[model samples]
Target: METPIKIDISVIVPSYNGMPLFKTSLDSVLAQEGVIYEVLVGNDSPSDGETKNYLNQIENKDLRVFHNEKNLGLFGNLNNLIKHAKGDIVHLWSQDDIMNPNCLLETVKFHNSHPNIAYAFSRVEVINEHDEVIDKTPLSNNDTMSALTHTLTSLMAGSVPGNIANVSIRKNIFETYGYFDVNLKYSGDFEFWCRITEHLPVGIIQKYLIKLRRHTGQLSRNPKMWIYRIEENDAILETLLNRVPKNKLKYINRGLKWRVYNQYFGLYLNLLRSGDNKEAQAFLRVIKKYSNISGFYFRYVILKILSVIKRDKKFLHWLYYKQAFGNNGK
Candidate 1:
């Protein structure tokens, strides 16, 4: 009989014509040290000849490539990859992102030390298309912050403490909590984090172990994608509100308003800048739908008027920063 493979981590890369960028991602995973891991690349029916040829040329013993009969979107491809993963832990890697050499080593060490933690994530380094480091994620390192408080507060503030590329979770968590909601386009990962955090304590590694690439092709950069994100986030917040304890109701409600206000305001600004008046008005309507607080509307009108008067993107951005973070920039 053939000997069974004992893989500690499975790094699943879901690709759809992500070539040039995909090669960088694959190379990083191959270079990971201090772990028995396998790299699985799921090609979502690449129609491009070059991408197909690239997949055909992969000959690594530790890497396996699978192709879908038809095109499955991001979450769909992720689900398929999960089904094929044979490792005890799974890391859903992004096709355009690069992993730090110690990503797997650090994540495995953390999980081993904290056997109770089902989900583990580390800090992220944000990079641009040219591979230049732009920013590092500001994930709180205060050990006093409870997992529930950290997760809820982050989500409510319209931010994620860690990106998907830096996350690793036990395979059993999926069997217990269910897989990613394939229907959600933008907030699926966000919702999954919220859900899993409710059931299991999350482990945080303060090191920057993943590079999240920001480029024009990224879905979040697409102006049209914000509409769907707003809708999905609203639904996610409603579900969270229902699950939160009564004692935490006040905090949850406050976070909800903050999240809604920021999302609507940002999208409204983007639409206005893009000269999409109709969409901008639609976003304003969404803002009113979420909150009747006079301050929210006051800021909306102020920003709209300022945008028209200045018509300078940089000045408008400065104005937004001043209003949102105060003049001292804190």
Candidate 2:
């Protein structure tokens, strides 16, 4: 058999309370074939007994470890890891996910053949807590952000949003963009992706390149359950809108379905949580500013009126029961 081709690739996996999944993550990176790669495991755990054990016995000379005394969140941890990476190609690995043995092997092959392409992403198999493949994320490998936005947003609606595990951006994009924003607890990935994708077509592998294990241990979709997502997402939206030109992002627009859905539901929760009718009315005004008035607005208004009245309001609840949810505990 002939010797496999070798190319230096830096794999950065940022860990936070990932003791149980760290070994599987590390082993997956180590299993790459026909490539020279370094596994840099950055631990952000409160105490590192378990993670430290794995790091100490990582017999591979290519595997190096960094212990972050203070736990930097995802964006901060990723920025820190990038600074320590020294390989020709770099990959951002999730500490809880498993990379396919052919992931780096395939990516390197694509990179070697297509030197002009600065970034490439692969298809990822989303697994449940038990690690069974439940879904897959398709990538838009072309170099335009507008086209990518349309492609990715469709994936989001289809249920599997693109993630860092499926992405392998080129080292040059990082050199130009600098680092991921530390200010955002969420939505930072999209900001970075939007910027890099501005110049290059994304490269993609149609095969399932990684197994994304989702469970209680991960923060996968808890943020969506938040009643204040509209408030939070609105803040990030404004930040991006200010920096990026609207015409530049032609395929995208102000009135997206996610924005509408989140705003409508978030306002409902806000009305219920409001201490008094006055605060609730103020929230309603803000909601109108974000979206156009519709029938849903009238439905919520009636619910608030009933909530505000000081006298018996059993009838109001029943009326809103039919209007708001189409059933009132029937």
Candidate 3:
């Protein structure tokens, strides 16, 4: 008789219409080196028959599939998988993201070495729809407080931690701190990270261990997603305001306001360029409610003046590219 394999890690992939990309994600998980892991896929009521057929054809015994009768949102599906996971270390892998072959081995090793750290994460490489590298996010080696403060500041400044695919948490962290908030549409991972950082130190593995896919179909591209993200960010900021040290609060607040104003102004510009005058006017009203930052208002007026002269989508696209990618043009 063969000896039973002891699972050291459980990768929970919460999938909704995750076909095509989900295969790549699963293959990456299966390819991890020097670690005994199981891949648990929680299917949130995929509407297509092809997706169902694909799930049925998965032949690996280590890969388990759970079907939900109704469509559970992302976090809800994650919660379902967490309950079924048997490993001490649990990783939430997005269906669209690909993991490096050594991702599991390194994260598990880091966790074993630093037993006190609640979770560990590696740096991530951002990829486009074609699996081409677009950007890389390298996390600095900082103590718990410093890292937490920096992350909060960045969030307030309109920058998000690109993808949570590189992170692996102890199963106990969720038991102690609670699961991902289902209420949040886009910022659940951000809020969960903040919550964990409040009580425990997080380990940073500097290697690029995961590829985060960004495409037109992703939630980040949806205009409505931005509204949810901004609202959730405000709530997260308020929570962090009460938790962070008094000395850092002022600086954090300033960054938060700057980021908020910039995001609102960017949205306003996008609406104007798209010729959605009604939505643009409505967004202006929303922007006014956030802050009275003079620079943002000035930029908004200039963009509006330019729009009045001629609605040049090409110019708007170029300006957006410059702001986002700078001279490198990546």
The candidate scoring highest on lDDT is: 1
Candidate 3 colliding pairs: none
User: Whose TM-score is higher: candidate 1's or candidate 3's?
Assistant: 1
Better of 1 and 2 by lDDT: 1
Estimate the lDDT of model 2: 0.63
Residue-level lDDT of model 1, residues 274-318, one tens digit each, is 999998887777666776647676656665666688753444334
Whichever of 2 and 3 has more lDDT, that candidate is: 3
Best by TM-score: 1
Residue 263 error, candidate 2, Å? 7.4
Tens digit of per-residue lDDT, candidate 2, span 1-330 = 997544478898888777777788888888888788887778887586887777877788778888888889888988888877777678888988999888887877766666655466677788887778888666554432243342333222321235787677667668887788777676566656655554455555666778887777556454333334345456545444444444433323322322344346455556656554665555556566545556456544554565588422465334322232222224
Worst 10 residues of 3 by lDDT: 321-330
User: What ranking of all candidate models by TM-score puts the best one first?
Assistant: 1, 3, 2
Local accuracy of candidate 3 as per-residue lDDT tens digits, 1-330 = 998777899999888887788888889987888898999988896676666788898798788998888888998999899989999999879888999998989888878887776667778898998899998885665423344543554455433344667778899999998999999878888888877776666677777889988899888787645655766777777776787566555555544444446667888778889998887777676666666657787655665676788753344435432333233223
Better of 1 and 2 by TM-score: 1
Q: After superposition, how far is residue 223 of candidate 1 from its true place, in Å?
A: 3.3
